[model samples]
Target chain A: MPEGTFCNRTPIQSEKALKRLLEDTGGKTYYQEMKALEVDRDLLWGTIQKTLKSRLRTWLGICAHCGMCADSCFLYRISKRDPRQVPAYKIQSTLGEIVRRKGNVDNAFMHMAMETAWAKCTCCNRCGLYCPHGIDMGVMFGYLRGLLYQQGFVPWELKIGAGMHRVYRAQMDVTDKDFVETFEWMVEEYEEDYPGLTVPVDKQEADILYTVNAREVKHYPEDLAEAAILFHLAGEDWTVPSSGWEQTSLAMFAGDWEACKLQVQSVYGAMERLKPKRMVGTECGHAHRATVVEGPYWAGRPDGRPPVRSIHYVEWLAEALRTGKLRIDPEKRIRVPVTIQDSCNYIRNHGLKEITREIISHIVAPGYFREMSPNREHNYCCGGGGGFNGIGLYRPQRNQALITKRDQLLATGAEMVIAPCHNCWDAIRDLVEEFHVPIKWSFLKPLLIKMVQVPEHLRPENS
Target chain B: MYEFLAGPMFILSLCVFFVGLLVRAIWYVRGLHWQMDRVAYGMYPGPGIKGAARSIGYWLLPFGTYGWRAQPFMTVAFFLLHLGAVLIPLFLLGHTLVLKAATGIALPAMPARIADFLSWAAVIGIAMLALRRIALPEVRILTSAYDYFILLVTAAPFITGLVARYHAGDYAFWLSLHMFFGEVLLILAPFTKLSHIILFFMSRAQIGMDYGIKRGGINGKGMAW
Candidate 1:
């Protein structure tokens, strides 16, 4: 609280340690690769000129210098009140400098801007909530990312992931054959418990078309198993498309509009062919919001494509419960107290907090479900939302910044922390491990699978 | 000097202020081009307009926003500063007499006691903000020379007017000095950060509209209001 005693509560990482960690995480190597790229001033200036619309122009001009947003930033708080970590300072340094230079900045300046845009800020938009003017920092960072992407200054992981999505239609390059095989494998695995289980693939005109993050296929296949079990128990007509099953988009985070369109079009194009009534995107916040909320704008369609409405996984679950398709036994709920880390994309940006709370209230036993303070839209980000999970450059700083979130979770004193998002799950799990926080972490679906009851008629005959 | 101070110089500054504001308005609006492409899902005008209405009150009241709830001191300081700045100038009996003499337009003025309280309150508010900007390292880093200069320019009229009222110096000289600073501020308003007078409403409304339509409601979690 006092001068020189700021941020004494948390262990802020030193610059030397951060650079060392960047080298250790191979972020330094990536920076060197970035420096090797050809610099184009004309294209950079043209992009800035095109994107500096009136809204952003006004925000840049009208900041009152009250510093109300400083307390709202996790990075600034965790970094012991570092001036550079302040959200306004970060924006003023990058976009402010761009405006000052009138977009005619050199390569050296571009490199610095890219670091601030991609590494320093998470683009979570929490600052917007605390800003009296309600400046949308997330959208501003998004436009900044767009400008950076135009100059081919994207992070290595995002560039590669976007390329994979363009060519392979999935982040991990999971082919059609492999995707079907994985679904079949999940069906076989779930059938061991619920004998009549089926993981339908390419089923045309199905009521629900389920999509997932490719990481489920490459790393956490059990999440797919959980989905298969839920659908089977509900007896709903759901199918996974063999092609375009991947819904995650690196292009959205990287701010590559062309690639974003290509990736979204691939999924919707496949859905248009299959003709499902609705598409249930898996528990990946960025992908869910991008596909459902932002796809219209990115694709240049004013009216969003409505034939197959894209819904978050929790929405699908809430609908199932409301319709009596999926039943849960209140008695079978987990005994340990649990808290939620509201994904910024889903809750803050999209207004899914109420429904999320509704679902959690039903799933967790009454005494066990403790709501984290600043729970709903006001929740702190998990430090991984804006592709920070994949970008190795800021791993050390990110870990340090995550202390605020870690503290929020710790304050709840819950044994289990539910992150209904893949990125948040990874980030929360990492912080739990790093800080030695005595809590288990999970995605919402897996926990739901544990408590949800399969009807006797839907269950296996023998078991 | 008094004749010029209250006559042509005042009218000339008022023209600069008004014309400059019009130019700024036109330039900002003309540069605005909507991209029907990326407006988020569920974005519609009904919620945006309603949200803008609610947001006007939300932002106008100093304690009505979450930022104020989080940092009450800063919020109070700003509220006092803006309240004094806008109200004292518009309602002061001295200014009303000047306006009546200049344009043959008469308007009611606040009681002298209330005007005195407002003037001193505003001066104190300005001092607090200036001290915070200069003292707080986080805020200081973003503070430009223009920021300090504008603070001085706006504060000079209030300070000199108070001094002239008390006859701290030659009454006419102090009054002339106050009028000169007041005219300078009017001339500089549109071109400097002082333009926030208009931009605050415009920018806040646009943000409220965007958030309201995008999220389908004005009241919800994480909203500043």
Candidate 2:
């Protein structure tokens, strides 16, 4: 998320894209269009202003600003505990600027405010649990970000995300054939680790629908390999579809609510066809968090929402451990101290945090977890999820989030940081390098396999 | 020349102040394009009769089923401030009240007895709130000079009325002068930060029921608490 041709490409790219869309759309008014989306503008919205007042006033009255929110903000932790970098201040001051200007402001002011709003926060809501006064900054910013996106004010990388979502139907430009090919590749790679492994495509009546964060197919292919390896070793009947395989949803974070609806529809449509007894959301935190819970909720479920069972990777893996089907080798790991990062989305309403510990304890000793200072339910973001890592405009904000993570890693004195999700791994890895912090990042499953104490008698053929 | 300028200037200020504020509120209401879906991230289920009914409550009762409705103390404060505001205006010599009720008996100590006590008590109200505005971090962050001025203008008529009543000698003339300014405060009350007096109930009622009921829910992200 740092130092690309972002600045150079953004100006022309944004200008051209905005002009192109507005030109094609026939003079759309952004605000008017947003208020009454998917409807004709000629229909008079009599209560439109009344709706705006309640929303704006609620937004205005929402924040209690106790600074507990500072704990969850990635920027504060990454910036070595600078208070200004905390998420609460970002909301307070940005909204304060809007109020001070009486909502009539220039683009420069908006640019800075939007950066703070969109990038500085991961929309994780870890802090939301701790709040004595429940103000949802994630929702506030999400709504505003959606409005901004309509105005062509989204981050640089996310333009591509929106495009991918629009055309290719994935977070990245992942296609149906590419998805199938990757699964075929993963099956071969996984066999070296766990023999007789098979990842099926469009398999009817599978017991589980396992969704991988799209990052697995693109950059973090080892995760897919690890997932396949683990699932095979555990002897679970899971299928990764050629269609509904990619699950890391940037749309949830990009504030593209419509896009989010479309995604859930696509994923669920595939689910209805496969008829999996349960859906296993992968190690990606926000993806799982957004998909099963928020996505279905947002879509209105107008005629009653689908009731697919949703479980976290940790919970599923922990269940796998109980079955005694999965085992790992501890000697392959770095053998230094390590701690698990509890992804906010998976932990809160889903309670995957404890299960993550259950996972680490199943493989490594309890003492290996040095903990992330303000850890567990109160964990700071890794400056990644909620589309921040995918957004170029959020580089500095994401960099700020990296500050606390760097400090935390330095304090842990651990050799490795086990982040369960790909985006978290990416953010942690970037910050670890960017801040010159001496720590390596690993997905929990890979590290878990590394440290699972693979007996010398049952070593892999390569070993 | 002096009389022409003085009378016209005073009239112009009153007219501009009152009309400008009303215009602003009207413009905001018209421009905001507000609705139930807009609030709480479109969280309100907007339960038909139940939803509308839940938003309104007995003004005198605390814990009335409403989002921003007044509690007993706040309601008392509301009545005192508003009653004192309207009643003070009624007693002004320019109003038809004095001419009809008094006819000649010198205006009943220029604002009677009960109205006078609340006037003095209002200073305490203003002070308590001003202290609150200064002390609380949330309130303090949102404070402005206009807020202070509005407080002052609000307390002004009461202070001047009290002073004019007890001061004697030219007290009647001073009372008349107090009445004139008191009327001015009323003229501007609905527009300025004073509007919060009327607005606080609406805000509290909707916000209350929004968070309170499960059936009528609000959608949106949980805030960065």
Candidate 3:
């Protein structure tokens, strides 16, 4: 989190100065590869034309430049209102360039445009929900990125992320063995606490199919253990998706639009095999945003499978809390002043704000959620949300993005920034260390599990 | 020569402006092309009774009473521009007044406003809106050159008419300037964002009506308020 960690000492300002971007492109701009893929040029232009025709007016007509967009961003609030970074404005400029091009810009424009449009926006559509005009900058950015990718404007980080998306169906290409290993680790940890608890994977025909971001398997495995304990206590009939269980779609974040559809289709393909009634996104924002909002729009669903019935964990857990199936005493908040860092994807993707807080109130200090200015759908991106954390080049700009966001965490004087999404946690975790705060960060599942009051019948007599 | 051109431009601007606004109203009432900006805001998330009521008010006001009261300076200014659009051209130049004088109702006195001071007020109001769009950074930020051009396109007739009526030309000269500007705006209105003026009330209404019927709706405040 040292501001220097993301510093590119020489900031490239103009098209001529961005030669590093071209040679540094990690060797493929999709426009060069597009004709070879045989993706139709006319169809590409038509979609671009249609999207602009629909949005340009509102894009130009926004009356409230209240900088509410910066407020709504997790990156900004987490960075203490850095005043330098605003995703909406970043989007505005890129979109402005595209609009200025009138849809006839060069591959170079596409390259810079892609970085700002595709890489910058998570396509979570959080700001759109809060916009006074309800402008869908995410949707606009998505199409603009898709158009750039189609025309050979691919960036290096986005290019590699897209490739990873192909390999693992998420950003980091962890294998099925890795998923199983992660689950086994969780099972072993959970058994030490509750010997009877079953953290079963690929348990076909289970009522619920649980999923989590690849980040959990790779980094925050403690969160997975929390899942096992909570489900064991609740006696829920859920199974880890044997295949395609990772709920992080970095493809969506990378501006790899085609890969995004394919990644979600794989999850549904796995869902069909398990045939679970419902699929829950593991605290990851873009994954759920894609699953509910965008995934349904795509044409194919691996074997042409229909879209799955999906909702986030907050929805399911909050429902359980409301119905008396899940219980927790707020007074037993062992690790509070616990402030909930609302993930932008969670709010922008699903408008699940009320439910997110309602669930937290059951187990943690509801007051622990320090109101990051513009939390919820209006909440800022965790500069690292989406695939930006993995984008090596945008790191300092990412740091710059989180100036106010860090200040918000410091203001609360809390020990933890409880983010549900893995990338959100990872990005904020970096910021925490760098901005010089030691707030232990985590998702709701692990925290909930750690605080659960073991029911009398469930208590082990050995103690 | 003036007879033929003046008659049509005069009647046509009046007809198109009046009729185009009506179609825009219907489109609004019916909620055509609106993707529901009202829904997510919690002002009216659903297209239910409340939304419908809101839409109805939004539509009727521009055509009826509240249109004047809501944005009086803007409404009055627009009303004047629209009035000058019709009266000056057809009456002064198209010979409609001479033609209709036999049939009865006389055109209202516009060139002569109440005590003359209100004439300056109307001119000043148009200038104020134009200045606001240019001076206010947020409003300025939203507008494009095309947008500013339309505002100027609209202002010219009144401005030229003000000059022509006071100093140089006959009613015909002022009439031609008014008709020319009116016709250009009408023709371009459908294509540009300028159409939003004609389109806003109806869009709001349809969104309002849509919200009126729904079980739960998103309104203006980004919540279910």
lDDT of each: 0.77, 0.57, 0.58
Q: Compose the digit string of candidate 1's lDDT tens values, residues B66-176.
A: 667777777777887788788877778988888788877788899999888888888888898898897887788778887888889889999999999889989999999
Query: DockQ of candidate 3?
Result: 0.11
lDDT order of candidates, top first: 1, 3, 2
Query: By summed lDDT, which 10 consecutive residues of candidate 1 chain B come out lowest?
Result: B34-43
**Candidate with the greatest TM-score versus the true structure:** 1
* Tens digit of per-residue lDDT, candidate 3, span B1-225: 356445655556556756776665464444322221212222223444455455445334433322234334445545554444435444443234533543344654433543134434446656766665666443444445765676677676556656665766676777667657756766655555556655544334333443332211331222221
Q: Candidate 1 residues A1-463, lDDT tens each?
A: 1111111111112434323323434444545545655556666677777768777887888776667778788878888898887788888888878878777776677778777887777888888877777676767888888777767677766655656666676766577788888878977876868888888888999999999998898788888888988887888899998887888888788877777787788788878989999999998998877777677566666654434777889888888877878888888877789998899887887778877777877788778888887767788889877888887666787787678778988899999988889989999888988899999998878888878888988767777
What would the DockQ be for model 2?
0.05
User: What tens digits encode model 2's per-residue C-alpha lDDT throughout B1-225?
Assistant: 323222454455456656765564454344432122222223344432233233333332333312113123333444456555655554544333443433333443344565666665566666655665676443455556766787788887777667776796577666666656655665665655554444444433433333322211222221111
Q: Model 1: which docking level applies?
A: acceptable
lDDT of 1: 0.77
Worst 10 residues of 2 chain A by lDDT: A39-48
Model 2 chain A TM-score equals: 0.80
Model 1 residue runs over 4 Å out of place are: A1-30, A304-307, B1-8, B40-43, B100-107, B215-224
What range of 10 consecutive residues in model 3 chain A has the weakest lDDT sum? A1-10
Most DockQ-accurate candidate: 1
